[model samples]
Target: MKASELAALIGAELNGEDVEISSFSSIENISEGSLVAILGNKIPEDIYSSSAAAFLAKKGADVPAGKTYLFADDAELALVAAVNALYPKKHRDGVNPAAYVADSAIICENVFVDAFAYIGSRAKIGEGTEIHAGAVIGEDVEIGSGCIVYPNATIYDGCRLKDRVIVHSSAVIGGDGFGYYQKHGRNVKIPHIGSVILENDVEIGSGSCVDRGKFDNTVVGEGTKIDNQVQVAHNVKLGKHNILTGQAAIAGSSTTGDYVMIGARAGVSDHVNICSKVMLAAMAGVMSDIDKPGIYAGIPVTSRKGWMREIAYVRDLPNIVKRIKDLEKDKDA
Candidate 1:
């Protein structure tokens, strides 16, 4: 397609003459006839010298002179649009011959079950949903329309997923929660009978898990985006639009309000209640309820300001100890 045509299709403004774009690429490697996406704030120094058909970038981003550009207010959205237009998602509606779908399973219209995929007994595969190869839909599971269960993902028995939920490769939903009790001397395993509910528009990242509840459902609210390797423990309730970054974890029964963001590797302790609009920095350890909304940091998290103060004091600790020793010697003399 022409650069101007793609801009028109994606609701972006075209800044230069129309150029034929045959493919798409990141700013790292630009090839002729490829639509290069500039996601960073500053244009790469090599972009001007690179061979590229056109550019897709932020509306006000500086572009190399004489380059054809598609400028959007949001560059990420524009990239999604460009990718969708270039390589549209193909829906293969029929179940493959090698796929094993149980007799009691209800495979809806426009659904695709790839070879080696297993749709368990009594499972309802909704319309436009794709079960990729080696994916397993457990018995009695209810998957909603437009969902994508990627390769090797396992949806355990009795779990429910609402519309447009994307379970990426190797994600295991409805896994047994980490629940045990002390009995006599050895630890006794407790049975987790409850399921996990992934609400509409939620995306479970690759290798991530939402464990089953002890007695009630573990609910991830609508539009929450979980990053890779994240763990949402048993009975945890995450509010709408919460962003759980990579390696972040929520202990059992913990809850967070809407728009909460947990940075990479942050840990929320068990049963903690986090209020709306709170942001926890990377590697933060939240051990108690966060009643007020603000930026937080450090282990056993404090307010961002308090954490900064602690860092400053710790950096000066050696000097302070030497001064104290000198004062003691002077007094002895």
Candidate 2:
């Protein structure tokens, strides 16, 4: 595609002569006729010297002399737009013969069910949805329009996933929650009778599990993105646009407000309420409710400022101990 056309599609301002951009490449591997997105404030000297045809750069970044640049307020968003324009995904619209769809299931127009996929009784699949090979949609489940259920994903009974939701391979939605009661010196299983609701535009990563609630719904709000291997326990309510990174776990009944970010390996205890716009640093452990929106870190998480001070104090512990011993020896003399 022409550089001018790509810039127009991505809403970027083009500077310098328009050139043909065949594909995208990384900084180290960029060749002539390819486009590369420059991220952050610093641009490497080698990138300026590279043979790339044009750069997708942020609005205020300094461009090298004579280099073609396509500038946008958000360089990453522009790059994504460019890539989608260059390589649009092709969708196949027919149901495969090997699929096992129940007679009572309702499949809307333009839906694609791949080979070996199973749609249970009374399930409703909306228009433009794609169920990949080996996906199992349980009884009475409702998946909205334009959704994609990747291979081997299992949506247990009664879960409802809204428009444009993406369930990656091996993700298990609406699974029974880990709940038990002590009865006669034995652990008795507590039934998970509720469902899971994934709101519009949520993307659940591969290997992640969202367990069903005890009575009410386990709701994952609109535009939330969950990373791989994350566990969202029963009755957890995640608000819109929240990001749960890899290995993050939220215990049962925990609720997070909109725009909250829980970093990799972070955990929130049961029944904890995390407020809007809160940011939990990687490996943070939340034991109680967070009423204020702020960046928090460390085990038994605290404010970012407090965590930093604690870290500094711990780093100087050895020197402080040595000084204390010297003072004790002087007192003995």
Candidate 3:
């Protein structure tokens, strides 16, 4: 695609020759024929030396000379569009013979079911889906079109995976969550009488567990991508396009806003509400509701800047105490 053509497709303004470009990449690692995305105020001094054929820049950004610039109101959106255009999915045709599909199940055309795959009774598999080897789709599960269930994945009964959903290897969707009660000095288990609802374009990474709700549905909104080893507790409502990094855990009934980013190993307590566009740093433990959008850190999870300052003060505490002791001895002498 030409630079001018990409601008038209992404609703951006072109500022040089309509040169043909094929790929998208970051500024620092821009390949020779790729389109690089640069934020408005993030143009590095070395950007002029980049070998990228074209650039995606925020509107009103300073365009470097001798390079083609495509001005977008939002550079991130332009990058997403360009990547999607350049690397559209390529699906396989027909189901594999090794798949063990139940006779009562309904499978659509052009689907790929790999060896040892099991589709349970009354299950509905939509068109263009690819279920890899060793995957088990439970009874009455409804999987939408263009979805991908990777190897060794398990989808429990009555779960609904909407269009374009991707479940990676070893991910256990619609599993019963950890909900137990104490009764007469003994542990009593609560039966999970609910299911999981994964909306369109959601991706569950390998080894992740998305538990079913207690009485309702545990809903993962469209375009959300959960990373490996993450645990999403029952009844959690995750908004669209939220990014959950590796080992992140969301307790039961917690709700996160759209476009939220939870860093690796961050934990959100039950019943907490994190507002839109908020970012939680790695290992941060959130115990309260975050209604404002900003970067957060710490165990109790305060502002990232405040946490940095607190760390600085703690680092200087020993020196300050030694200096104070010396002054006191001199005064007493």
Candidate 4:
């Protein structure tokens, strides 16, 4: 599309001549006729020589020569919007010929059911929703409009996904959590007798597993984005707009406040409460509640500065031990 049209679609301002952008690509791999994203002045040297026709750049972004720029406050988001506008996803409407949708299920207008998809008894699918190939929506499940259930995703019975939710490929929602009891030397598996509730605009990435609650709902609040391979255990309540990175694990009964940022591989202990605006660093092992909002890191997760200081102290342990030994010898003399 033309640069002016693209800017209009993405709500960005067009700065240069209106050039037709055919496709979208990252800055580094962009070739001729592609639209790339320019986030800042620190463009890689090799990417500066790319043959991209236009760039979706943040306001005040330093644009390389020979590219028409669409200026946005958020370049990455603008680029994503631009890509959606230019390439627009083709959502096939109505039931697919190969899908097995129950006659009792309520499917609204403009709903798309792809080949091999299964909608169980009494399932309710709202308008403009797309259920991709091999997706399984269990009995009594309710999914709102503008939602996308990607290929091979599984939404178990009684689960409720609010509007605009995106469940990526292979994600298993409402799956049984790891709840077992040691009874007379044999482990007894506890039945997961609860459901999952994904509020509006929540996007769960591929391969993520959100276990069904033991009794209450495993709730993910509005606008939260969970990265790929993340594990959200039973009864874990994630507040609005939380950003959970890939491989993050929230143990059962843990609740996090709005705007919380949990980095990749960060683990929150069971029953812990993380306050709003808290930032847990990558690989942080949180064992206790974070009552205040701040940056935390390390195993047993402490303040970043304190953790760094402890690391520095531990690094000097050998020297400190030798000094103590010498002091003892001098004292003996």
Candidate 5:
């Protein structure tokens, strides 16, 4: 696409001569006929010197002389738009002969079941949904319209997924939760009888697992995006638009309010409540309820400010101990 055309597509303002862009690339790897976006406040010298054909920059960003520039309110967002326009996702339109769909399964119009995919008995696949090759939809599973279950993803029996949900490769939905009981010096397994409900627009990352409930549904609210390797335990309720980063784990029955952000490697203990807009910093360990919305960090999770202060004081402990010893010697003298 030409610079002016791309700018019009992204609703950006154009400056300098129009240039043809065939692809999108990073600044470091950009070549002629490729476009790149400048994300930082200042345009780097390397980016300015690169042989890129066009640039997507933030409004009011400085442009190199004679270089083509397209200005957007958010350069990163504009990059997403440019990439999508350059390479649109191709969806298969119909079921493949090699797919094993049960006779009782209800597949709606425009749904695509790829080769070797399995749709179980009484399963209902909504319109325009795509079940990629090697994916498995267990018995009685209900998947809504326009969803995509990527290759090798598995949705176990009786789980429900709303519209536009994306289950990345290797994701295990409705898997058994980690529950056990002590019995006569041995561990006994607890049965998870309930299902998982992934609301509209939710995306489960690759290698992530959302466990089924012990007696009721494990519900992930609408617009929530879970990162790779995350674990959502049985009966845990995640509110709308929450972001759980990679390696984060929520223990059984814990509930979080809308717009919560749990950083990477954070752990939330069972039965704890996280209020709306709460931000749990990386590696935070929450053992109790968070009643107020704010940034939290550290084990047993304190406010971010308090945690910083505690860290500072701990760093000065050795000096304080030495001073106390010197004072004792002076008194003795």
Candidate 6:
């Protein structure tokens, strides 16, 4: 695509001689024939030396001498639009001959079931959904339209995933929750009879697990994006648009309000309710309910101010001890 064509497609203004852009790249890794994103108001000094065919940048950004520029309100977003327009995804439909789909399973139109994929009894695959190779959709599972179950991903029995959901490779939805009871000095497993419900536009990252509920369904609210290796325990209700970063774990029965952001490796105790717009620092541990919305940090997370004060006190511990000893000696003398 030419720079002028891309600008027209992405609603960008062309500001230089139109150049043929065969591929897309970033400013850090500029290629000879690729269009690169040059963000921010001021152009970078190093960008002058880049060999990119065209620059995708903000409206007021200065274009490099003799180079084409596609100006947009938001360079990043426009770049995304340009990339999608330039490289469209290929749609693959129809069940593969080698796929194992039960006779009772309902496969919707425009859906694709790849080879080695398993669709159990009474499963209903929605239109425009793709069940990739090696994926397993258990009995009674209902996957909505435009969803993609990547290679080896599993949606256990009775689970329902809403429209536009993306389950990455190796993700296991509706797995058994970690619930046990002590019986005769041994651990007895509690059966998870309930399933998981992934709301619309929710994404389950690779290697993540969402445990099924014990009684009621474990629900992930709409637009929540969970990162890789995260864990959502049984009966936990995650609110809409929540961001659970990599390795974060929420214990069973916990509920979160909308827009809560749990940092990487953060831990939320069971039964705690986290209010909306609360942001936890990486590795922060929540022991109880967070009523107010604000930034929190540390193990057993406190307010950002409290965490900073604690850090300061710990840093002056040796001096504090020396001052205490000096006062004691003066009194004794």
Best model per lDDT: 2
Better of 1 and 6 by lDDT: 1
TM-score of each: 0.93, 0.96, 0.82, 0.91, 0.94, 0.94
Give the winner by TM-score. 2
lDDT of 6: 0.93
Question: What TM-score would you give candidate 3 relative to the actual structure?
Answer: 0.82
Task: Judge candidate 1 against the unseen true structure and give its global Cα lDDT, from 0 to 1.
Answer: 0.94
Worst 10 residues of 3 by lDDT: 39-48
Candidate 3: stretches off by over 4 Å: 2-4, 13-15, 22-32, 38-52, 64-69, 181-188, 257-259, 271-278, 288-295, 327-333
Scanning candidate 1 in windows of ten residues, the lowest lDDT window is 40-49
C-alpha lDDT of all candidate models, in order: 0.94, 0.96, 0.92, 0.92, 0.94, 0.93
Better of 1 and 2 by TM-score: 2
In candidate 2, stretches whose alpha carbon ends up further than 4 angstroms from where it belongs are: none
Per-residue CA lDDT of candidate 6, range 1-333, in tens? Answer: 888888989999988788898898776677788887877555568876778788787888655567788889987789889999879889999999999999999999999999999999999999999999999999999999999999999999999999999999999999999999999999999999999999999999999999999999999999999999999999999999999999999999999999999999999999999999999999999999999999999988999999999999999999999999999999999
RMSD of candidates 1 onward, in order: 1.9, 1.4, 3.3, 2.3, 1.8, 1.8
lDDT of 2 by residue, 1-333 (tens): 999999999999999889898889887688778899888656678887788889899998877779899999888889999989878899988899999999999999999999999999999999999999999999999999999999999999999999999999999999999999999999999999999999999999999999999989999999999999999999999999999999999999999999999999999999999999999999999999999999999999999999999999999999999999999999999
User: Model 5: clashing residue pairs?
Assistant: none
- Local error of candidate 2 at residue 224 (angstroms): 0.6
Error of 4 at 288 (Å): 1.6
lDDT of 5 by residue, 20-81 (tens): 88998886688778888888665568776777888888998766677888889987788889
lDDT of 6 at 302: 97
Ranking by TM-score: 2, 6, 5, 1, 4, 3
